[model samples]
Target chain A: MEVLGIILAGVLVNNFVFMQYLGICPFLGVSKDFDMATGMSGAVIFVITVASTVTAALEQYVLKPLELEYLRTIVYILVIASFVQLVEIFMKKTLPGLYQALGIYLPLITTNCAVLGAAMLNVTKSYGVVLSTVSGFAGALGWSLAIIIFAGIRERWKLMDIPATLDGFPLALISTGLMSLAFLGFSGLFSNLVK
Target chain B: MGDRLLVTPSPHVKSTKTVQGIMLDVVIALCPAAIAGTVLFGFRSALIILVSVASAVASEALYQKAVKRQVSINDFSAVITGLLLALTLPPHVPLWIPAIGAAFAIVLVKQVFGGLGNNFLNPALAARAFLLAAWPLHMTQDWVNPMTYDAATSATPLAGFNATGQTAFTLKQMLLGQRPGSIGETCILALLLGGLYLIVRDIIDYRIPLGYLGTLAIGTWIFGKPGAFFQGDPLGAIFLGGAFIGAFFMATDYVTSPVTPRGRLYMGIGCGLITLVIRLWGGYPEGVTYAILFMNLVTPLIDKYVVPRYYGSGHDKMARKGGR
Candidate 1:
């Protein structure tokens, strides 16, 4: 039940893109098409999930015992970077099909704030390893859901007669605003349901 | 005489109205509210309006000149944007506030995207939202007492009504614009005249205003009172705040609103529903600007689904048969 609540909270109530305003770069950049958005989302889900588990374990075993908690930011970022590099190599060696699917976006995910944010947030919330993994996977899933829906909307948006000045980023930003407004409905969902 | 017909290309239909003509009509319509706002408040109100309009026009011209594009300053669109932004500001805001708002509207919101016909959101309202976020205290606490022009910090009718479920002003004062609120939003008669003139001159469609105001009235009447249901002051809800101006001017913007008639009606109703929700239950005392801007974002979707039946498609019959 707790895991269910965390997943629900992560996917809907605390969506990384529309709700928390995280990972906006890729949210806007790769959201113009559907297939690319899917690939990007898949890569993110794997990396964030792995990165969260490792960072949580490291904080529990290393930082807490040494009382070097303040260095957690630097440690977590370094772990995430190295972990993504390892994933890239492993995917290329054994799972080349999946590696090519993610292509350039795999490298881009290293800098994505959502990944770093998930790692840091797991530590901040002091989640156990199990909850950390669940929250990270759920956060990435929430991002996938948002990007997919936005991609569908933009696909249809292409045919509409948009004004010249609003053809690109301006229109995209307004669309994000409306999407955020819709996501605002999810606020307090977990709290209301838990009671 | 040789009787040869002139076979022109597509778009054979032509109209006498130009973009400048439409924008000029809007400017003329806004005159009554501008005059009334200045009269009710002091010279500061007039100065704010002038600075706002001038900055908007100047920004557009300067941006175009800098970018080496043909300057379209002759069209009064920037002036209209400036006027709309000024009307939404508090009467006592510093002169720089409107100037900054105008520059943001014209340069960033409108010109950056392309220009007049290209902006996705209502430039004036977006800039107002930006200003509100940047300086909430100045925007909310700078309301001057009407007529006296005293630097009063009294809450507006909507604010008081939302907080205590009551208001000090009566129906007559509300109608006659004797309240402390945004400069142009206070006067119903002036805004009505401008809105009516636009409708009469065929500058704007009537369905948007009617649908927006009607939905707001119904929604507020149904759920306005805090605890008691169906016991809310619908009239006061409609008259107070920026609803009157928003419904008529900002929401009816040509570039941001839907092109089809029915789609525009839906836009209006959607805006009204959002506005009521925000006003009655949300944290804000007013929701006109955000409501309209939100609906503006949805305009494209409305246009997509609410398309008029093609002239001779007859696909409706096949679709019905397939459904069965």
Candidate 2:
């Protein structure tokens, strides 16, 4: 039940992309096509889940005991960056198909705020290691959900008769606004279930 | 008359309507509300509208000339945008507010994005949102009394209702535009006349207005007042704030709204739901502009998913599965 609450909170109630406005670069950049969006989402989910578990363990055992909390940001980024690198090399060796599908996005996950944000959020919220790990996986899934759905909707505009000026980024931003509005419906969803 | 054989592509049957004609009708439709606003708020309101309109037209022409694009001011779309921007403003804001807002609307929101037909968000509402964010005090707390035209810091009816579950004005006064609010949004009757003219002329789709008002009325009736669900006043919710103008004018904008009939209906409902959510629970007293703007963003999504069935593309599984 607690894990369920954590997942719900991370995905719907506290969405990293639409609500927290994190990882917007990848969300917008890779979202123009459906396959790319799914590939990016899969890579983010893998990295985020692993990075969250490792960061939780480090914070609990190393940083907390040493009282080196001020080094949180740098440590978190270093941890997430190394984690993404490991995933990239591992995926290239073992899962060549996915590696090719994700292309540069797998490496770009190091700079994604959502990964670091998940780790930092674990510290700020003082969540336990298990819950923090749960949150990381959920947040990445939430982001994937948004990007995939957005990509599918974007394909519909391929043959649309649009105005000359609203062709690209402007239209995308507006579409994002509406998606965010739809997400707003979930604002109080976890209030009853989660503390 | 010398006869010349002409070879033209599709759309060989052309209507008498042009961009200029449609925009002129919009301007004419807006006159009742504009005139009412001026009569109710004194000459300062009129001056502000003029300044906003002038700034919008000048900005468009200047930007086009600067960018070496053909100056399309003859289409009258800029005039309508300027007029719409002016209507949404508070009557007592400094002249420079409208001027700056008009410039931002034209240059940033409309022209930079491509031009009149291309802007994703409604230029006037986008500018209004910008002004609101930039000058919250001027936007929210600067309402003048309707007839007296004095600078009174009284809360609008929506604000008061949000706080106390009751408003100072009766239904008649709310409908008649005898209230302290934005210049053009106060008068429900004027807005309705304008809306009716557009609908009758077939210039605007009726589904959007119907869907928006119907959803809003139902939502408010169910959950308008805080604690007293289903006992809430629906009429007041529809009449007050910018709901009337937003539903009729802003949400019904062709470029910003969905092209298909079903998509348009969904847009209306979406706007209504968001507006109700904001008015009832969100921090803002008015939600019309943001609601419409948000719906404008969703227009493409709506158009995609709610695609009308192609004629005679009957029982084709591949066609049905294509959206996935």
Candidate 3:
């Protein structure tokens, strides 16, 4: 039940893009089309989950004993970058179709602040390995849900007569703002039951 | 030639009613709630409504002029947005709250989305949710005593109902809008009249409201109580909170709702599900605004996948795919 609460909180209450304003660059960049958005969401879910596991393990084992917690950010970044490469190579060899589908987004996950944000949040929240992985997966799900919904709205923009100036990122940002406002309803959600 | 051939967004069904006609009917339908609110919440409520409506129109006109577009404020959609937003607000809020909310509704939610018929979410509800987020203190705490119209901060009956699943007010009182709540929402009688008028006038779809209220009734009946099954008060549940007004006015907004008949049913059901989740277990005492707003995000998705089969088309894959 606690794990479920965390997942629900991440997916709806503390949404990555709408609530926390993380990974917005990729959110706005890759969410132009439906297929592309789904592809990025898939890649993000896999990468963020994996990175959370590795980062939590590292924080638990190396940084805590060595008292090198200040270097955690740099170390985590290095670890994430290398892990993404490993996934990329592995995917290219075994899953060429998915590799093609995800394209550059697979590699781009290394720089996705949401992945880094989830890892850092795990450290800050002091979540153990199991909880960290769950949080990471949940955060990735929230981000994916946002991009997918945004992509659905964007698909209609193709037919809308929006002003040229407010056509692209401007409209996207405004729409995200409105969506975030709606999501505010979920703030402190399940406070009654979870506690 | 251009004037003869009109091109509009989705909802392409031919109708004798112009946009102005439909919006005017909506205004008329909403009049009962507005008047009931003014009377129930005293003169301050009336002031709030006026300020909100004026701000909304001014914002629409100013935005149109700034953007080099035709001023569309005369259609009364902005007026409706303002009225709806005001009705949803607590009566005792500083006048500027509704004003800012009205401006936010028109400029940010409506006009920025290409104005009437183009907005993806119900502008007024979106703005209400925005205000709730921006000023939680004012939005949640400003419910004045309904008839006495005093400054006493009375918690809505929903707060107690949330915990005890019991109500002090009878069905007669809830129907008469005697309970303490947002200015307009307390008056289920007026809102029902308005809803009936809209449905009778063919200004709004019946399916959406029916599906929404129906689902809310059944869901509340099943899960409204803490432990018992089928022990919840469905009548009290629907009459409470913003459910009635939201179902009849906001959820049925043509721009934000589904176009297809079947799709609209799904929209209402989706709204009911989300509202029940939030009110029951998620958060908050009422969930109408967020339920409708969240469903607004999925309106397009519903439209995409839930299309009705074209007449005379076979059920084959190619034939089924022909409508799109």
Highest lDDT among the candidates is held by which one?
3
Per-prediction RMSD in angstroms? 7.1, 6.2, 3.4
Error in Å for residue B57 of model 1: 0.8
Question: Least lDDT summed over 10 consecutive residues: which range in candidate 1 chain A?
Answer: A186-195
- Candidate 1 residue lDDT tens string, A74-111: 99889888888888898899988888898568889988
Across all candidates, what is each one's fraction of true contacts kept? Answer: 0.03, 0.06, 0.72
Clashing pairs in 3: A190-B282
Task: Give lDDT: candidate 3, residue B62.
Answer: 98
Model 2 stretches with alpha carbons more than 4 Å out: A1-28, A31-50, A66-75, A82-104, A129-195, B1-14, B313-324
Residue-level lDDT for B54 in candidate 3: 98
lDDT of 3 by residue, B116-163 (tens): 766778999999988988898899898887778887556788877766
For model 2, state the Cα shift of residue B289 in Å.
1.5
lDDT of 3 at A155: 85
User: Which portion of correct inter-chain contacts appears in model 1?
Assistant: 0.03
Model 3 spans > 4 angstroms off: A192-195, B1-12, B313-324
* lDDT minimum window of 10 residues, candidate 2 chain B: B1-10
**TM-score (C-alpha, index-matched) for candidate 3:** 0.93
DockQ, all candidates in order:
0.16, 0.21, 0.74
TM-score, each model? 0.74, 0.81, 0.93
Q: Which parts of model 1 are misplaced by more than 4 Å? A: A1-21, A34-111, A122-195, B1-14, B313-315, B318-324
